[model samples]
Every structure is written in structure tokens, then in C-alpha cells.
Target: MASFLDIIKRHLALSIWAFSIIAGILLSQTSIDFRAGVSRLAMNSLYLPFTSFSRTYHLLRDRRVENLRLKEELTTSKLRVEALKEAQRENERLRRLIGFSEKIEYSNLLAEVIGRGTPRMPGSLVVGAGSDRGVIVGLPVIDENGLVGKVIAVNDRSCVIQPLNDPNFKISAIDARSRINGIVSSNSRGKIIMENVPADADIRRGDAVLSSGLGGLFPEGLLIGRVGRVSVPQSGLFMTVEIDPAALLDRLEEVFILFVGIAGEGESGVEPPEAQ
Candidate 1:
């Protein structure tokens, strides 16, 4: 009952307009004198209501169209703003990479990340440069932070690189502080693991780890990461070690591929690249 009353209230204006139309039709049917002045006055009276209704309808229609246009303009403005912010961030990252490359000894090719490796293969990324730009397999890649990965496969225009955190990746590393040698590998969770360390080794938490140059693949003294955890198996003679990589592998966008061998090979402390 209350609902029915609310519905009727909402449509009361329409109902009144319909009722007026019916009442006017019934009045016209009555036996009335056809005087010219009275007929003209009646026609004028009926014309006003329909003229107001038509004007109201057109005004409401125009308002709705204007509101839609404003909403579209707002949406487009938001998208443009976001695009500009992203471009600015990318420029900053590139600037940092260029500065880091100039400080390093190796001649490097700045490569942009094009895509990621297949889901079946973890810790791999596809870079924009390939054999066409002299990018060869086994070239080391790094960013402003530290070592990123090594090129595994190369094509004419692109190449695939395996990051240091991949399960199958391994590097000969040493404790930077104590000068102790160890083998670094990745576990299933992509965490760095230093294996085959004697239980009596002089390693502890927060020790810096770096490449030992034993494998001949990576240059000596490249920053790997810091030690996180140290434990010993009850039966084994060696200790289990966890390492944190110097680079953030998951969020890399641009990197430098080392072709000249060592960082700061020619001269040290060069000027930073100009910001674009």
C-alpha cells in the first residue's frame, strides 16, 4: 500500500497531463455554440500546456547529453595524466642505468625489456636487443643496483636472459668480509643459497657476498648479495647459507649488458649521464 502510493506520487504529473487531455476531448463533444472568439480562446488555452511540456522535454534531453560529455572528458583527462607519470618514471630509470654504465669498466649495450619468458621457465626475461646489435650468449646484464642476469639465447632482434634467482643458476661467490669461498645457487623459492661451507667457516648474518671469478663466466668481485641465514645440517659437515641478491630481479625494466668485462676498467669516478 505505501509502495503503491509512492509509485502514484512519482507519476502524478504524467497522470494529471493524461487526465487533462481526456477532459478536453469530452468537453469538445458537448453541444456548444461555435462562436469564433470562444473557439480561438479555447485553442489558445490548450496550446500553452502542450508547448510547455515539449519545452521541458527538450531541456531535460539537452542536460543529459551535456552530463555524458563531461563524464567522458573527465575519464580521458585521468588517462592522459597517468600516461605522463609513467613516462617520467621510465626516464628516471634510464638515466640511472646510463650513469651506472659509464661508471663501470665494461662496454655495455643498454637494453629495454620487451617481454618475459614462458611460464614454464622461471626467472627469465626477453630483451629488445639481439645478435643484430652484437648481443651474444653469456653476456652479463646489470642495472643500477647490481647483477641482473646473463644472456642465454639470442636472435636477430631479441634475446632471452636468465636471472640470478633462477633455480638452475649458479655462481662462484666469496664472502667479501672474510674472503671465504662458496658456491651460490637458487632454491625452489628463488632465494640464494650458498652451499658447501664448512661448519667452522667464518660466515655470519649480514656478510657481503661477491663473485669469486672461479667460473670464468662472471667477472671477479661483482656484488651478488648479503648473507641472511646460516645453519648446519645435523649430519653434514658443511653449513647451509641464505643470500639476498643485490638486484631487485622482479621489477627490472631497463638493464646494461656488459661487453667490456669489468666495471671501471678504463677510469673510475666519471661524470653521470645528463638527464633527459
Candidate 2:
């Protein structure tokens, strides 16, 4: 019984002493070169696996961050491309307007579209220029395509334009092909109706319509619209004609108001000035 326990306690101190002696003999080498080689080999063996794992983890983290950064840059580039396209379209529109304005014979006031009229009445717009820009009632407003409307009301900074689709708007126009005269007016149905055309008139579809200078409001030769459908009822003496206005009113964003110059003559066939 004292046999097994006493034997282990006696051997434990001896085991520790033997280990220390062997370690001291290895550390106290005869040559410094031998010791340096052993230390290098031990350190490499101990740290190689840990160092490799650390490098792999950092590489993965950096790759993830770079992917996120690339995605954000791609999104921003798409937005910038869209913005550039919109700007190009606007520039083209302005260029066309400038060329159109140069050929007209009246003093012009350029106005930016501020607001649109109620959607229920499509074709009308509010402009930023009004009396302050010399815009007055009955002034003809036109875009690059053709006549858009006339000024119906004016304030200091803004005015309301009555589009050609309005019932109160009328322009004397002539068929460019046949030279037949008629009045282009809008009905309550939002259709432009050409009146005063004779039943036997030779007007046809696709005939260009131009302002006839019959009214003192619109300038002569300004494009008005094109004749669409021409009908002659059995008992009717006048032809029923439909016209499509030349202006793209629904997409209008800018307009030029025509001011009657002091030296500009009144529209052809207008009455002379009355005595004051």
C-alpha cells in the first residue's frame, strides 16, 4: 500500500530535474550559429499557420469593401448619364426656338413656362413674362413649331395663354395648297373647326394652313395648322373641316410673345385707326 504512492512521489522530482538538465544542455550550445538556426526553425513552425490565416481574413474583408464601393459608383454614373440626356434635349429645343424667333418680324418677349393649366383643359399654360415683359392681351404666342396661343390675361410677372384648343380662340387662316380662306376655331369638344369654307372649296387633307392676316391679332404667314377631315353634307352650303393645330401644346415648355412694334403695320384688312 505505501508501495505505489511512495514510488510516484519519489520519481516526480527526479523527472523535473532530468527535463531541466536536458533543456539547459540544448540552450548552451558551443557555436552561436547552431543556436540561431534552432531558434529560427522553432519560430517559423509555431507562427506559420496563424500568419497565413490572418492574411487570408484581411484579403477577404478588403475585397468585400471594394465590391460595395464599385456598386455605389455604378449607380451614381447611371444617374449622371440620365441627367446629361435631359440636358441635351433641352439644348436642342432652345436652339430651334432661337432660329424661329430670328425669322419673325415682331418684337419678341421670351418667357419660361411656369405652370400648366388644369389637366381637364389640356393645351393652356402659364408663362413667367406678362405686362412686365410687355405681354398684352391678344398678343400671339408661338413656339418653335408654330402658333401656340394668345395672351388672355396678364399680371405683373405672369400671364395666362389661351391655347388654340380654347373655344374663344380663332385665327383666320388659308390653305397653303388651294389658297382658300377660312376661320380656324375650337369647339367645346376640343376640336379645331374650320369655318367659312365654301361647299365647293377644293381644300384637301394635309393642306398646310397659315395665318391669313385677316385678324389684327395673329401675324400673317405664321403656321397655324393642317386641314384634316373635309366634309360636305347633302343640304349644307359650307364645308365642315377639321384642323390639327401645328403647335404641340401638351408638351409645351416655352413660348415667345409677339409684341406689335410701333412701325409695324396692323394685320392686313384691319380697319384704320379711329379719331381720338
lDDT of each: 0.81, 0.81
Off by over 4 Å in 2: 1-50, 118-123, 261-276
Residues 32-78 of candidate 1: C-alpha lDDT, one tens digit per residue: 66556677787689776787788899999999999999999999999
Local accuracy of candidate 2 as per-residue lDDT tens digits, 147-244: 89888888988998989888888888899989999999998788998999999999999999998877556777888888888899788789899998
| RMSD value for candidate 2 | 9.1
Global Cα RMSD, each model: 12.4, 9.1
Per-model TM-score versus the true fold:
0.73, 0.74
Worst 10 residues of 2 by lDDT: 267-276
> Backbone clash tally for model 1?
4
Q: Look at candidate 2 and tell me the lDDT of residue 161.
A: 90
Error of 2 at 4 (Å): 32
Candidate 1 Cα outliers beyond 4 Å, as residue runs: 1-45, 119-122, 261-276
